[model samples]
Target: MKARNRTIQLVILAVIALIGLFTIVSNLSAGPAKYPQVGDKAPDFALAGLDGATHKLSELKGKTVILNFWGTYCEPCKREMPALQRQYDKWKAQGVEYVGSNIGENAITVRGFLDQYKLTLPVWLDQDQAVRKQYGVSEYPTTFFIAPDGRIAKKQVGEMNDAFIESALAELVKK
Candidate 1:
């Protein structure tokens, strides 16, 4: 009788372990899905920039906007800043707005990074990852091309060179 009870206890423990593993696996894989697809309306979000200024997505309406999500620790995110800055400078007068969402960093750290890179584009600090979740961004250096009508014209992931950036901007600028 004791042996049978011990066997039952072991079986219950194994079942519990399996259930825990399944829950963990499912949670790790689950996340907010991507939404900045082409032709979709650019999702609106509000956050504090590195300069202590609040920016709302809806405020930049009637202009072409490039919404980029990046982080301080991401190598590719750092790599694309220079090109993005250059693009911002070139077409800024042509009605292009460049907004950056910094994930996983505080305002001071992000401001230092912006200063270090001489990036003049406005960067919003997403310290709590709320904006990132709202945008459904899963990776660093994800960019959305928002048109003058507030539609997402394009969505780019990973590091992109000046040519690709310029091409996307050119398409959005015509509006």
Candidate 2:
């Protein structure tokens, strides 16, 4: 009887091990998930800014807004900050707004990075990471060009220069 009990225990253990191995293998076979596509309604989000105020995507509904998702640690993001700043300076007078959403970073760190780079654009801190997930931003630097009607005009997956920004802005900005 004891031998039969030991045999049953061993079989159960083996089955559990097999189940675990199968789960791991299945997970490994699954590839990376794809992000959201263009033409989708830009997800509404509210995040605390570096200035201690909160910013919501729904609040800025009338004007063309550029939503840039970036992190300080991303080299490409740091590289493009200057160009973005220049574009913002030139077009801000024309009622274009550029917002940089810092993903998964503390406000202090983001503030320091902005100060170091002398970036004056409004930055929203997505510390909770909910907005990042909402926007389907798996990468470091993704940009969404929002039209005056609050729909996504264009989706840029990587770094953008002043010319690229200007071109995108020109399409959305009304004359």
Candidate 3:
């Protein structure tokens, strides 16, 4: 009986080790990490907008893109929406594109929030959080400022104030 119990314990340990090894190998073979650093070219992703239009990061090559990841339920995201909208409105004529990505939410939910706030910032759906995971967003309101050349100029986690938003845009548009 003692030998049998020892064998069972060994078998369990071996199974756990195999699982860990498999996980490590799987991550290694999954290609480069999608978490892009500052000055690195932002990873390209395509998401559907409310109007059923596809918005792709790579397609906005010559325009400074503000890629914001947010959820409707987040209060900070709600508070900063106006500031983001203002900057987007103020700088869009100068070739600044704002891609408001709603993480893990359906269109109806996002539409309701948009209607409640009367927001005009073109929001895209990140259903299943594929884009969220790709961008390595662990916070509710993470913003990525992509330069006109497609390189990430800055990445901001947490809520941003109006001045910070303006400053980032000022730099992005000037480049």
Candidate 4:
């Protein structure tokens, strides 16, 4: 009886091991994730803004779009908001679109932050963080500079200076 039980247990364990191995092999066969890179078409997403509008990225095609993924809790993000607003002020009339995506924060908190900073840039609420994952954003203040033709001109991973933004904007807006 003991030998029979042992044999059954061994068979079950072997089956489990084989299943695990198969899963691993199957996962390995799947290719790596492809995120939007510079020159690739930026993925389109529609998210509600703090301004009570559902902003869609595809609709902003033919204009240079600054899609910034930020979090209210991130200090670096906070540091850059003013600079972004300044650039927006300077460039909006020239056909630049600003899409500020606040990741995983409630409207009230985001509102308070924006208010406290006196920043006028329109912020899109990424309440569920779906757009963050779509953009493969692992950090705060990841900014994508999309060209007038809807291609990604640059992907900035951290806090941006006024100078860097100005230069990128120049490249983006050049005739």
Return the top candidate by lDDT. Answer: 4
Candidate 3 per-residue C-alpha lDDT over 1-175 given as tens digits, one digit per residue, 9 for 90 to 100:
9999999999999999999999999989898765888999999999999889998889989999999999999999999999998888888899999999999888999999999999888899998899899888999899999998899999999999889989999977776
- Residue-by-residue lDDT tens digits, candidate 1, 1-175: 9999999999999999999999999988787565566898988888887767888999999989999999879999899889999999999999899988888787788878888887787888887888888878898889988999999888898998899999999877875
Ranking by lDDT: 4, 3, 1, 2
Between prediction 1 and prediction 2, the one with superior lDDT is 1
Error of 2 at 56 (Å): 1.0
Clashes of each: 0, 0, 0, 0
User: What TM-score, computed on C-alpha atoms, does each candidate reach?
Assistant: 0.78, 0.77, 0.80, 0.82
Candidate 1: regions farther than 4 A off:
1-34
Candidate number with the higher TM-score (1 or 4): 4
Count of backbone collisions in candidate 3: 0
Which candidate, 3 or 4, would have the higher TM-score against the true structure?
Answer: 4
Task: Pick out the ten consecutive residues of candidate 1 with the lowest summed lDDT.
Answer: 28-37
**Per-residue C-alpha lDDT of model 4 across residues 1-175, encoded as one tens digit per residue:** 9999999999999999999999999898776877889999999999998978898999998999999999888999999888999999999999999999999899999889889889888889998999999889998889999998999999999999899999999987995
Candidate 2 C-alpha lDDT tens digits along 50-168:
88998888888888898999999999999999999998888888878888998889888888888998888899988888888878888879999988888888998888888899999
Q: By lDDT, is 2 or 3 better?
A: 3
State which candidate, 2 or 4, has the greater lDDT: 4
* lDDT computed for candidate 3: 0.91
